[model samples]
Target: MNRVEIDGDRCKACGLCIDACNKHLLTLSSDLNAKGYHPIEIHDVEECSACALCGVICPEGSLAVYKEIKPKKGG
Candidate 1:
């Protein structure tokens, strides 16, 4: 499984990540952050491909993508 962690306090709500996401899983939050900007939120984490495009596109560096690693069965 893959996941995206967003730092709302650092996010500027520029919408660049939203445009960069191919899965359309990212969206702006209804609540405002300390910076008075609607932070980005993931609609469906399971749909994320962990392509890192959103994180790469974000100027604020608020988004972090992590890919889960599973051990081999007979290792």
Candidate 2:
């Protein structure tokens, strides 16, 4: 399954990833991290397309997008 892994402790809560998400799946969490910042969270991971826009926009490099690769048949 395609997913985005977030390093909340490293996040600076800049909101760039939130704005960059085309599906608006990313949002600032209500809870604060060790750095006392509201890190970003995925509202619905199932909706994520692994487009990597959020990861690309994040200045802190906190987001990592992973897309599953299935082997082709009849190889």
lDDT of 2 by residue, 1-75 (tens): 788999999999999998898999999999999999999999888888899999988899898999988789999
Q: Which ten contiguous residues of candidate 2 have the minimum total lDDT?
A: 40-49
Q: Please report, in order, the local distance difference test score of every candidate based on alpha carbons.
A: 0.93, 0.91
Q: What does the lDDT come to for candidate 1? A: 0.93
Candidate 1 lDDT over residue span 1-75, tens digit each? 898999999999999999999999989999999989999999889988899999999999998999888788998
| Runs in model 1 lying further than 4 Å from the true structure | 73-75
Clashing pairs in 2: none
At residue 17, what lDDT does model 1 achieve?
A: 92
